[model samples]
Target: EHKRTNMNEAIVEKLHGTLSILRRERDEVHRAKELAMERLRLAKEETERMERTLQASKQKYDALMAQSTNNSNSNSNNNCSNGSDGHGGKVNESVEIMQLKKEVERIGREAKFQHMEYVSKRDTLAKLKNHLKAEDAQRSKNIRIAQETLKKRRAKLANIQALARNHISTDGTSGGSASRGRANDNGNDSGISGGAGKGKNRTSASASAS
Candidate 1:
């Protein structure tokens, strides 16, 4: 009731306009989202199509390779009939023998390389062992040298400590003896002065009496 009487008409009109603008924005956002989803779906379909094409190409390549191998085999067995009469068993046997020869050569090469690698590794291991032994020997020698040096240093320190202690004791005894001697000399001087003072006083009294 209060809003009906007090509210401005222009403000109400402005609010209605703002609501309409907001509704348009909401619809635009929904359309943009739908477009994005559609693009995503199309991208997925394209990826699937590319994958299928790749598979077909791979199959075609395999077929070509197999056909080329068969042709090579057929050409190599020339003594056999040009057609399939004598070429049948001979072509298959030749292909098998060639495959076996290639496999055997590959195996032999691998074995040779493995043997060489083993020898190299063995030599390297031996060298490493020698190096480790040399290092151990040097470390032991250094340890012995360090121990001898430490022993000499300890002996020198002990001698220096003994000398310092003797010097300190001698200084303490000399100081005590000097102090006692000074005290005795001061007592003797005071006694002599007191005797002279008494003799003078006695002589002065005799003169006065006479």
Candidate 2:
């Protein structure tokens, strides 16, 4: 009989130890999830910033292109007027027009390069967005699994407590104090679980806002 009682006590102790370990693991996973969410938020913000920069660069490039065209037209008009005066002026005007053409070509090339850079940034942003979505989905799955595991663990713990109480009562042992202690422990566990739930809700809200 004494051996049986000792074995029952050992079983209860083992259950308690397992529950504590599981709780610690759950906490660690929650922390890791929060870190991943923060990183994803930062990545989204960076992508938005790049998009704004790309838009500004495009506008600047367009303005420079239009100005180049206007300058070329003005130079052409000036050359036509100077052609009525002399051959020397015409030759000088021709050189000036060549220089202007070279400048316009250089500006065009720069605009093309800028556009390519913008396209590259856009592609990078898209990849980052896709990566963030995948991470979010994975994180949600992990959290759901963790919650399910916790629920199962809680159920197991409750069963163990009930069995322990029943065994002690059947043996006519002084188990009231132990039962009360277990109840207090369960209350503490409930509080921890509630806090975890609140944290999860807050995280969800933040993700939605982002």
Candidate 3:
């Protein structure tokens, strides 16, 4: 009866130990999940901010384009006005107007180029977001695989425990006999005082046979 009680108590202690290990594994998995979610949220926010900046650049480019068109119309009207006037100053004023129109056209082309640059930047931001998403997915998958591996290790540990229990139960009466066997295998030692001694010389012979 006492032996049975002792066995039951030992089993309960082992169960508690296994449960503790499982709880630790679960907490680690939860922490990893939280970190992944935080990264995903930050990446999404950055993508949205980039989109807003792209839209603002597009609006600025369109407004500059409209202003350039109005400038061109105004320059044409000034040329006509200069030709109709009889004053000697009108020819010089027309020449100045032509130069100003050239400058306006240059500014318009610069605005168009700036718009193209914004589009390229927006595309790059999109690619970054896609890459981040793929990385997040891969991280999540790896976490799942790790958790599964932990579960399998825990199961293997349980099996080893069971085998140990069976060995102890069945060999309860052979403790001294097993110790004698081990002592013979290792080469028996007797001592009144201790010092270094040669290890068993033929130890690897049995291992090599196997």
Question: In lDDT terms, which candidate is top?
Answer: 2
Q: Compare candidates 1 and 2 on lDDT and give the better one.
A: 2
Per-residue alpha-carbon lDDT of model 1 for 1-210, expressed as tens digits? 233323333344454555465456556655655565565555555555555555555565556557656776666665465553445665675666666556555555555555555556556555655665565566556555655655665565556666767878999999999999999999998999999999999999999999
Q: Can you give the lDDT of residue 53 in candidate 2?
A: 59
Q: Model-by-model lDDT, in order?
A: 0.61, 0.65, 0.60
Off by over 4 Å in 1: 1-90, 206-210
TM-score versus the correct structure, for each prediction: 0.49, 0.42, 0.39
lDDT of 1: 0.61
User: Candidate 2, residues 149-186: lDDT per residue as tens digits?
Assistant: 65666666666667778877876655666788899999
Which candidate leads in TM-score? Answer: 1
What lDDT would candidate 3 get against the real structure?
Answer: 0.60
Error of 2 at 1 (Å): 2.5
What TM-score does model 2 achieve against the real structure?
0.42
User: What range of 10 consecutive residues in model 2 has the weakest lDDT sum?
Assistant: 84-93
